[model samples]
Target: MIYKVPFVEPTKNYRMIKNEIDAAFFEVLSKGDLIMRGQLKQFEENLAKFVGTKYAVGLNSGYDALHISMLAAGVKNGDEVIVPAHTFVATASAVVNAGGTPVLVDVGKDYNIDVTKIEEAITPKTKAIIPVHLNGRVSDMGAIMTIADKYNLVVVEDACQSLGGTFNGKRGGAFGMAGCWSFYPFKILGGYGDGGAITTNDSRVAKMARLLRYNGEDRETGEYYYHGFTCLLDNLQAAFLDIKLRHLPDWIKRRRKIAALYKEGLEDIEELKLPHFDTPGFEDVYQNYVIRTSKRDELANYLKKNGVEILIHWPKPYYSYKALELKDRGFPETEAICREVLSLPMNVEINDKQVEYVIKTVRSFFK
Candidate 1:
């Protein structure tokens, strides 16, 4: 069932950078430094500079970044952390992993946490808010920050999908107290394997995150300070990521170009709702070019039958999962979006031919 146009193709991107990646692999192996070493340090430094942050701590995965950020932000047991119900489960699961209660809140039309709804969900137990910058779009950070200032709540941005996105000239990971990122192969700035980072201006939080990624040991002396987890990003992965990081600006530009093409080609369809691209003060990287339609199921089936592959970002809201014990609560917008949103083929390597083919196929569906 190989589709003519697949949802995402990481191999295409890999092939483009194969030579550099191979050289990076050889360099790391030749040096025999596969752990907390030079490559990882260089990657951390480059990432911090890229994100406009004072520090960035590399970890094994974005989940570890979120969990460690919560711990460092002082989200203790029984404390509540407000999170969007529309995001991936990892956003809320990270709070739970940090011994904090995840308080689910509904999202707005842009598929991000509704800042207007955040305050109502806050209680005396509220400790922080984790705003997920979904699908490369930056959330309302200015408003969210103002709310945080009023409530004295910590903000940890889940910026995994927004590596190159910006809000009012500020980068995605630089808005909150700490920002978490994922390099899970499919992301905008992906790595060869699982990798993540935490960015922050607070020296204390950055120091704690650095300690928590490893087994809480002094890097220079290798002395144990406290119990931690084995969440360090491998040096080989860091090497690959460093190479990818250099090409990120160009890649992001390509993605934006593709997104604009989609918008222009599909905007005329009365049954479809396009992603918000013209929001003032926000610059998106188009990590996933998503659209909404009432005939979502029919459209997906039609595209599959016609040799095009698509995906739903999430088929259900995060809170609907039984493990969270939140089935009773309702998120009307999140639930509605779960049934309507569809992710078309979006990647740096996606060409105009493929984009036009998808747009033609989609227009045919309505006809």
Candidate 2:
């Protein structure tokens, strides 16, 4: 029997609860509120409770969530916001969109911001630090938070890849002033299309974020208005997300189980370096299940030829391509890792036999 492999499959909890979503949609349609309505409110409240945050503001996309957070945090033009050089461009672009200059920082071997190197980069213009939790692993928040306190710099966690992930028992989106999440169909707690939320314990910051998303309407009066962009999450998507939210904990556990199976099967192979999920007290959701290999491009081609799918999370670092000011600075770690990182087949639906087949194919390539 032949088995076809896929790179990353979004969990299918939505399929199992199709009737619930249909019923919710019918109720929404009957009420004649589709855009920003009761469904959005319910999702925000439920998501906040799940993340253990005081407030959660839903937005149009993760990019928008980051953008709005920067604005709410008082980021201004010419102000410097320190960010990792290795993440998706959206992490940095959102800073620019909110009128801040993004200063690229190098990442450590764990593929997160090198906390040790952050102090030297801080300048008089430095206003905030955006710690990106890439590939579902938590960046060293304990250290990062300490640094932020020392400098009085606001921390905005870019937790797009780490919805169910945690650090030191606290969830990913609650460590900073506000943590940004992207529901771009591929995230663990994804919706049907573009969606995002900002989770935070600070009520003032949360209030600002909510106002920014709805064209600056005062939620209390529904009367006052200010200049703000329209980027609210749709009711239909929220209805769907509410259904999937119930099973998120189970889905996250299943992802970790699959990652363990991969590690056990592939640990002996020296050619591959797998990700680290056993960070002291935190649990990684294993969003991408990336592996590092010297011959990554060649291995990817071989896998595709053998009916196994693979993908590169990022081919270039954010600072190298989008922002021109930081081009002269060299980030060898980011560049080298980008060249070698390849994502394997990962999802809850993949059975034991499929995992074995993938490991066998990978080992055969190395041999």
Instruction: Determine the backbone clash count of candidate 1.
Output: 0
Instruction: Give all TM-scores, in the order shown.
Output: 0.98, 0.95
The number of clashing residue pairs in model 2 is 0
Looking at candidate 2, what is the lDDT of residue 77? 89
Question: Stretches of candidate 2 above 4 Å error?
Answer: 1-3, 9-14, 219-225, 322-328
Q: Please, what are the lDDT tens digits per residue for candidate 2 over residues 115-150?
A: 988998899999999999988888899999999999
Which of the numbered candidates is closest to the native, going by highest TM-score? 1
Over the stretch 1-367, how does candidate 1's per-residue lDDT look in tens digits? 9888988788888899999998998888998988888998999999999999999989999999999998888888989999998998999889888888988888998888988899999999999999999999999999999999999999999998899789999999898889999999999888878999999999998888877777897787888876888898898899899999999999988998998899999999899999865579999888888899989999999999998899898987767767777533578889899999899999977789999999999999998
How far in Å is the alpha carbon of 309 misplaced in model 1?
1.2
Task: Give me candidate 1's TM-score against the actual structure.
Answer: 0.98
RMSD per candidate (Å) reads: 1.1, 2.1
